[model samples]
Target: MTVLHEKLRGKDTGYWIIQCTNPLTHKRTTIRRNPKTDAKFKTKRSAQEFELQFLKSSMDLNMKFSGLFEDYCNYLEVHKSGKSLIDMKSRYNRFFVHLKNKKIVNIRESDMNLIVRDMQSNGYHSSYINTIITTMKILMNFAVKKGYINNNPIANYPKLKVAKTNDDLKFWTPEQMKQVIESIPEVYKTAPDVRQIQHIIRFGYFTGMRYGEIRALRWKDIDFNNNIININNHISKHNTERAGRKNGDYHQLVMDDDTRAVLTEIYENHKKQPEFTNDCYVFHSATRGPYFPLAATTGNKYMMKLAEANGLKHITFHGLRHSHASYLISIVGLSEAEVADRLGDTVAVTSKTYAKFFNQARVRAANKISSHKLGF
Candidate 1:
């Protein structure tokens, strides 16, 4: 009943194994079946029927690797955020291309390893290569759960090592940020995009919200009386869809007078627009409708142009969040937990990321202590 005439056994042989779970003990078991005859089936459907009879289970064996990928994509669309779904599709597309026409049970760790090496040789960053490998591992695990493959082919696959340094985490100085924001109006004139970019930059600097969070802002999310911003929605990078913020949850932040002022001005202007509505995005494209958000590329490009024009050190739009955190911890004297709350991160992550800035604060305190004796 086997469709594949190729006898594949052991871990090295490229063949798919059927994975099933015991109902009583909840333990997983793998079943490998070989045909009695050397005849190869003409159609994938016949092979599936034969596999079902041999295993005495309803799990279909005719699913191609590509077909399994489509099911995986469907799973992602339901369970994952829009950004994560987009990222997975982009990475898995390359993997599908490499493992074309192969059955899910027929893919081996060696095939995955070859793809990893190829990606490495293509000059991708170590972090990115690791991500690609991780994507494969996730798919294989999904296949196992769906009873297509018995085990994860690259479960033991090693991730490429990524180097880290202080300089790798880029942030703008307070002075540089001020200069860039000030120069935006002069550089871009009276365009609606300039206003949107300015507002996004100011929001990032003061609130430490991620790019997606800021981009997904809606008029209704702003509470003018309470001076609070309800971060309940996020627009994906392509501006094609919306979802919960990066953590798949909502967050709230109290706004300062300056931030409230900026929002007030924008809201008033928004009210004047013909397309303005309660559900309108806070930052929208100049050409697109008012409810639509701007694309990530366009926002980043505008920020970069502003930095270059103002003779300031260039940092991506996300860098503004880091800058906000650094200023809050080092200059505003906020506690690590408070900063973490503002940035939607744990205290440990905030401390580790801004350890250098915290050290500088300690040095300043030491200088003050040495300069003055205790009055007691």
Candidate 2:
């Protein structure tokens, strides 16, 4: 039911106020306007028509934003990797800190724009801000599918532009990579876990496997008979637990003799352990006894300390993957498609990412052309 009240603002001024009960919240919401400036009823009949229209619009309510957000997080736990779920939980926590239990139906594009503008004003990078915005849009779409909202208000929200730079795309030269690997302190190299770190660095350089895939490698994945290594699962960095690789499919690549020998050496060392089994992690932790895969920070921290000590260029573990790509194209003379297959990437992506290396290859091929001319 809607009720209208005539209130006297002053001796001569009066305003029309309409109050309607919200079905979802069970609270009354009031709308008031000065009768002279707006709401010129014209007649009792016309005023009743306008009052009905306004009350219907005001009383409509959708699900609460906080309630829907919880539902989305619950879904993520089952369907997403633990690390990804943690990242989303963090991003959403920052978002709800600002929005604070607003109704999903009442959220507007302008509100989203304001949030983005606020992030930009605070000096956050465009890419990070864009990721937050993308997460919000994902939640809103989920709400729509659940029939909480009629449509996504910010579905087409614009993403902020970020500048591109080669620093992010940097890859180590083969000489630099060799120097860095050789520079690991000899004392650390003798330690059991440090030996595994040494193996991981070299394996990343030769194989180009992502950090997750490399850490998740097991004894069973090594096909010594076929001279190939299988990449079937990955460990999420946040919880240090196994999950399917990023591509969610099994990948296999043949190893060169040097890589095979390195794996064999590690395997032989592990076989000395009476408790070692085929299911054990290839790079087991040292301090945590045996069979536990090294924590995600182990390789990253090792590379950082080694680079600082050796005065070499600071490159993370992923840099080792990029170094492998560069080595294959520039030195090994492998074709783009072949390199892509080895790296578990599509050919188009390989070509796009290593366009400079491909161009150099083209120049090398052109140099072999003879100057002899034939009549057409």
Identify the leading candidate in terms of lDDT: 2
- Identify the runs in model 1 with alpha carbons over 4 angstroms from their true place: 1-125, 131-165, 186-192, 238-244, 311-313
On the 0 to 100 scale, the lDDT of residue 242 in model 2 is: 55
Number of the top-ranking candidate, with TM-score as the measure: 1
lDDT string, candidate 1, 1-376, tens digits: 1223343556526544444543223456544443566444444455555565643343334556666677777888898778778887777676557675676667787887788788788887788878787888888888777556567777898988886655667788788888888898988896757777788788778788888888788888999889899998887765645656786588888998778888888898899988778899887767887777777777678778987898777788888888988888778878878888887788887788888877787888899898898878
Residue pairs in collision within model 2: none
lDDT of 2 at 250: 75
Worst 10 residues of 1 by lDDT: 1-10
How does candidate 2 score on lDDT? 0.76
Poorest 10 consecutive residues of model 2 by lDDT?
54-63
lDDT of 2 by residue, 1-376 (tens): 3555564366424445556555456677765542446654334445455565654344325446766677677788998878777887788777655664687888888888888888888988889888888988998898766545668999999998886443466677889877777766463766656667678888888899998898788999999999989888888876455556776577888999779988999999989989999898888778875677778788788888878777767878888888899899889999999999999889988888788888888887777454444446
lDDT of 1 at 327: 88
Clashes of 1: 3
Write down the lDDT of every candidate, Cα atoms only: 0.74, 0.76
lDDT of 1: 0.74
